[model samples]
Target: MSETDTDATATGTPDQRLHPWSWLFVLLQQLRQFIVPLLVLMFAGRGDHDAWPYAEYAEYAPLAGVLALVVVSVLQYFTYRYRIGAEGISIRSGLLQRNLREIPFTRIHNVGVHQSLLHRLFGVAEVRLESAGGNKPEGQMRVLGLQQALALEQLVRHHGSGAATTTGIAERPDGAAPAGQAEGRTLLSMPLGEVVRMGLVSNRGMLVVAAAAGLVAQASPERMMGNWLEQQVRGAAGYAEQLHLGWLGMASAALVLVAVAMAAIRLLSVALALSQYYGFRLIQTQGRLVVERGLFARLRTSVAPRRIQAWYQQETLLHRWFGRRALRIDTATGGGENDPRKLRELAPIATPAACEALFVHLLPGVQWPPAAWQGVPRRCWWRLFASSVPWTVLLVAVLWWHLGPWSLLAALWLPWSAYAAWQQAGRLGYVVDARLLAVRGGWWSRWWRMAELDKVQALQLQRSPLDRLLGTASLWLDTAGAGPLSPPLRIRFLPHAEARALHARLGRVLAARRMRW
Candidate 1:
């Protein structure tokens, strides 16, 4: 059959089918989702065969299920077809349901092209198109020629920028760029050293260890894993006793062991970071930003600046020591679930100056990290300290039960807590201008959240009984695509009147401007 058969005249392009191996990819995807359940079914069937009348036939159940899925995948591969049009793409699928979806280029907020090791071996890629307010990808092409996939991504991007009026793009089917086409300027690239630095500054290794331990403890019966850990610790203690080491020597040995473990965790983090971001690069091309990374499974994702609803910058104590900051953006691409496909990281690790330049370039009129910050009320410090009092009291109570007089030593924490609260409160501040509003908070781990006035979807002024008593209020700004854990776009501990004035001013600006995303 002709590859470009003009069967879809309305789209001004030929209806195209996925790669011949698309069925295999689809089957693999299905298997990945059900592999654990399939394993459990097979084992249970084998172990309990003697308990049921048709027990012997149970062994074949998983095989039968696999065969059925294979048939479904083949049918889906043959039935699915798509056409690229001037302004949008059309997808048709399903045999009985007969589903047809048309997604406009303008509405497509993020385009993700991924290539797994298997796909790379077959010279194919998977393409996912996401639009605003979607629970899943608007379109997912499981297997396409790598060249064709990139061309489709380029087509959508160009159309979004009004650079295309037809289905064609300046790219060859074999993956050659059009002659004289300007290659995008690279905004940031991570070499192995930087990746290692990022790994050193992150706690990914510790998180992995904690998650693995939790999983082990949950999976084991009767606290088997915990018992094993306790036995190992006792064995180590016995070995130390056999060595006849003094208390000082034992302490030194323990310190050395702890240091070694810490080193190993840091190394693990570096390895993980390298695997995920070996060839990371961010590029700016034709009014859009593209990021490509990964060592094993490569990803190339692109998004328009206009689609970004909010900006986030974070600098932990480690980040400050390493002179790096992480920048992320909230985009209109919504998958309802925590979508890994979303383009969140603009820069995973970069110097503060580099981040500033990127902000200036992407958001032409807005200043970053706001030059001047207005501090929160001093009473907010007292409020913060007071909130910690109950927790401190609880700790002291627990300690006193364990060691009567030692509980008084825990009271020393109150003074440290008060100092920390004072420092954090001093760092809590907000800045605003005609085009941007930003809030900065945190003491040891600093962060800034900012958004354009036009992107602010709602404004809220909150006053609690305690806040009222302290003559303080909070002003919160809401934006599209902001996650529950995202740093609140809020300025807390403002004087009541100041919060009202700021809220009213922001409300007026939002009312006058139309939200772009």
Candidate 2:
């Protein structure tokens, strides 16, 4: 097909028609996804002792399976054809009950291109279009070539820009340089060395925990150490029974060797993290940032500048001692079950003084509060300490009851909790300036998150019974995202009056922007 014809077919304009094979492809894709599950069920049914042998129904079963597949495939084919009109995209599908979905072009937040190993081999990729009106309205427009994907993204972006336009949101400038230009733009082209470095330095504490859990499960925790000890004692007793001092000494030496080997195996469990997170890369795309990492199965995620709800500069005690901070940006996208796309580390480690400069260059118009606004109140520490007491006491009591006299050691947690609370309170700080609001907190691991004032979706000031009694209130700031990315922009314990004043100030700022628009 000609390029123009291909574009028209891929985009499906109001007057244009879809490819004849599009619906067929969708049906096949759905069938492929279901085939394995169907086979597993068939096998499971055959294995059941109470169930009749498949041989009894074999003749009808094959025919029934074939008929079922045909009917489902036909229904899916009819449902998969989608059309693009001037206002929005329309999708129609369903078997007995037909359903139609229409999504306006204006509601689209970002368009993502996803290519799997199979897709790369086939020279096609999936295009996922996400909208701001929650997850329900979002849709996937699938399987297009690399060039076609780019054209579709541009077409959707520029659909309503001309005289027919009714939406107020302006089209992104065509010739304008991509968003991250001034901030040291890295292209689809990233150095292999940097990618390898990123993977090595990433925090693998979670991986270590996961491996430990897996090993504990496999070794039978209740008898694991005792079994090893018993084996050692039996071997020593057997050697002692031989009544040769030289042989006994040699056996003792062998026990020392076994001890060293066991210690090495335990150490290897943590070291396995190095192999899993290998070959990670942080690349700056034209209009977004891209992170590609993983060893066995690689993962790639791209986040647009506009979709970033908050940016966090984090530093643990070790990081602070090393004069380094990690930059993490939270976006609204979901990364599926095993993976998390919440906070993508931009730089694994960098100086705190350089963080703001790098942030401003990447995302323009972000403002930080003056030095005076950075101080958190001293009373916050007392509140944290008081709030932790109940939980600490309950935990200690449970340990004492369940673990007997040995559990008295759990009392040590009380002092640790107190220290953590004190440190967290000290780290908590809020910065409100002309253009943004930044919240900072965390005990051993420090975090400073800044969100643009204009992007603030909602702001709330609340007080619990205890907070009210203490004359302090908590502020909640909600932005556009799911879970952690949707964290309160600021949640520090502040004086009731001060919290109210801050809320009012933010409300006024939002009101003024709305009025201007």
CA error at residue 15 for candidate 1, angstroms: 0.5
Candidate 1 Cα misplacement greater than 4 A, ranges? 1-9, 44-57, 169-180, 336-338, 399-411, 514-517
Residue-level lDDT of model 1, residues 1-517, one tens digit each, is 1222233448567778898999999999899998987888798788766687999988788998899889999999988998878768878787776677777787888889998889889989999998887677888999988878887887777777778645463225554334464668999999888899999998889999999988888888977987898998999889999999979888999999999999999999998888777898999887789999888888899999998999999999999999999989988886653565678888899999988889888998676656788888765788789988998899989989889987989889899989988899989988889988888888888998988888888889999998888788898788888977679898988888988898888887787775433
**lDDT values of the candidates?**
0.84, 0.59
How would you encode candidate 2's per-residue C-alpha lDDT over 428-449 as one tens digit per residue? Answer: 8788878878887787877777
Minimum summed lDDT over a 10-residue window in model 2 is located at 1-10
TM-score of each: 0.92, 0.68
In model 2, what lDDT does residue 119 have? 57
How high a TM-score does candidate 1 get? Answer: 0.92
Judging by TM-score against the true structure, name the best candidate: 1
What lDDT would candidate 1 get against the real structure? 0.84
